[model samples]
Each structure stands twice: as C-alpha cells, then as structure tokens.
Target: MPTISMFYGILVSMYALDIDKHHLPHIHVRYNEFKTVIAIPDGEVLEGRLPIRQSKLIQAWVELHRDELMADWFLAASGQTPFKIDPLR
Candidate 1:
C-alpha cells in the first residue's frame, strides 16, 4: 500500500493491483487504531470504522478530490505508483 495523503492524524493510502475484493475505486484510511475503506465515486464506507468527526472529514476530502482519486485508482489498478494527492487542511 502506498500512502497518498495524510492530515491531522489521518493517513490515506491505496494498494497497487487492488480491485477485485472491494470491486470499486476506493482508498484506505487509517487514524490511530481506526481503519476503513472509502469508495471514491460516492464516498461510501466499504469497510471498517472511524470516529464520526474524522469520518466526516474524510467524506468531505473525498468529495473535494474525486477526480484525482479516480485517476489514482486507475493507476493503482494497473499496478503503477499513484500520484500523491493534497492532504486535507
């Protein structure tokens, strides 16, 4: 997994050649002990959990960077390194 961004205590990442399990364009997020997978197109939680405030922040970040995220998804699906995205600030 390659970390694409980090902010506040949250770390966002994606795995190269990953697609089948989740079956969607998504990113993995980790905040302390909480970890989750968030789908890109709709910002839905595909797995795990996060604190409510952190979850909302991640959703907002996804909405703000959907296009960039999708592009990164494509690169990752093809087993290429994804470009770093701007962290939420």
Candidate 2:
C-alpha cells in the first residue's frame, strides 16, 4: 500500500493491483488504531470502522478530491504508482 495523502492524523492510501475486495474505486484510511476502506465516488465506508469525526473528515476529503482519487485508483488497479494528492487543509 502506498500513502496518497495525509491530514489531521489520518493516513490515506491505495494498494497497487488491489481488486479482490472492495471492487471499486476506493481508499484505505487510518487514524490511530481505526481503519476503514471508503468508496471514492460516494465516500461510503466499504469496510472497517473509524471515529465519527474521522469518518466525516474522510468523506469531506474524498468529496474534495474525487477526481484525483479516481485517477489514482485507475493507476493503482493497473499496478502503477499513484500520484500523491494534496492533503486537506
């Protein structure tokens, strides 16, 4: 997994050639011990859990960078390194 962005103690990443689970454009988020897979298009939690505050932050970040995320997803699915996205400020 390669980290694509980080903000407010949240780490966002994408795995290259990842397709078996969460077969959609998504991101893996981690904040402290909590982690979750979130769908990129809708900011829905596809797996795992996070604090409500962290979850909201993730959704807002996703919404702010949906296009970049989708592009990264395509690159990652094809086993290419994804471009780093700007962190939420």
Candidate 3:
C-alpha cells in the first residue's frame, strides 16, 4: 500500500494491483488503532470502521477529490505507482 495523503492523524493509502478483493475503487485509511476501507466514488465504508468525526472528514475529502482518486485507482490497478493527492485541509 502507498500512502497518498495524511491529515489530522488520518493516513490515506491505496494498494497497487488491488482490484479483485474489494472489487471497486477504494482507499485504505488509518488513524491510530482505527482502520477502514472507504470507497473512492462515494466514501462508503467498504470494510472496517472509523471514529465518527474521522469518518465524516474522510467522506468530505473523498467528495473533494473523487476524480483524482479514480485516476489513482486506475493507475494502481495497472500496477503503477499512484500520484499523491493533497491532504484534506
């Protein structure tokens, strides 16, 4: 997994050549002991869980960067390194 952004203790990452398991564009997020997978297109919780405040932040950030996230997903699915996206601010 490659971390593309971080903010407010949240680390956001995407895995290369990872499209079969979750079967959709998504991101892996970590905050201390909390971890979750969030869908890139709609910020849905694909797996695991996060604190409510952190979840809300992730959703807002996802909405702000959906296009870039999708692009990164395609690149990662092809086994290419994804470009880093700006952290939520």
Candidate 4:
C-alpha cells in the first residue's frame, strides 16, 4: 500500500491493481489502530471504521479532492503508482 496523503495522523492509500476488495474506486485509511475502506467520488464508508472526528475530516477531504482521487484511482487500478494528493490543512 502506498500512502497518497496523511493528515492528523490519518494515512490514506490505494493499492495498485486492487480489485478483489471493494470492487470499486476506493481508498484505504489508517489512523492509530483503526482502519476503513471509503468509496471514492461519493465518500461512502464501504467497510471498517475510523474515529468520528477523523471520519468527518476524511469525508471533507474526499469531497475536496474527488477529481484528483478518481484520476489517481484510474492509475492505481491499472497497476500504476498513484500520485500524492494534497492533505487537508
């Protein structure tokens, strides 16, 4: 997993050629011991959990970077390393 962004201790990544899980454009999030798979472009929680505050921040960041995220997803799903995205400030 390659982290594309990190903010407030949250690490966000997308696996290259990942398709078995989620089966859609998504992101993997890690914060402390919590983890989550969040759907892209829509900000849906596909699986797992994160802290409430962190979850809200993730949603907002997703919304702000939806376009870039989708672009990165395309590259990632095709087995290319995704570009780093700006973290929520």
Candidate number of the best lDDT: 1
Q: Write out the backbone clash pairs for model 3.
A: none
Q: By summed lDDT, which 10 consecutive residues of candidate 1 come out lowest?
A: 17-26
Q: In candidate 1, which residue pairs get closer than 3 Å at backbone N, Cα or C atoms, i.e. clash?
A: none
The sequence of per-residue lDDT tens digits that candidate 4 reaches over residues 1-89 is 99999999999999999988689899999999999999996899999999999999999999999999999999998999999999999
Quantify all predictions' global Cα lDDT against the true fold.
0.96, 0.93, 0.94, 0.95
Cα lDDT of model 2 by residue, 1-89, tens digit: 89999999999999999989878888999999998999998888899999998888888889999999999999999999999999989
Tell me each candidate's TM-score. 0.98, 0.97, 0.97, 0.97
Show model 3 residue runs off by greater than 4 Å: none
Q: What RMSD does each model have against the real structure? A: 0.5, 0.6, 0.6, 0.6
The residue pairs that clash in candidate 4, if any, are none
Looking at model 2, which ten-residue stretch has the lowest summed lDDT? 17-26
Q: lDDT score of model 3?
A: 0.94
Candidate scoring better on TM-score of 1 and 2: 1
Q: Against the hidden true structure, what lDDT does model 4 obtain? A: 0.95
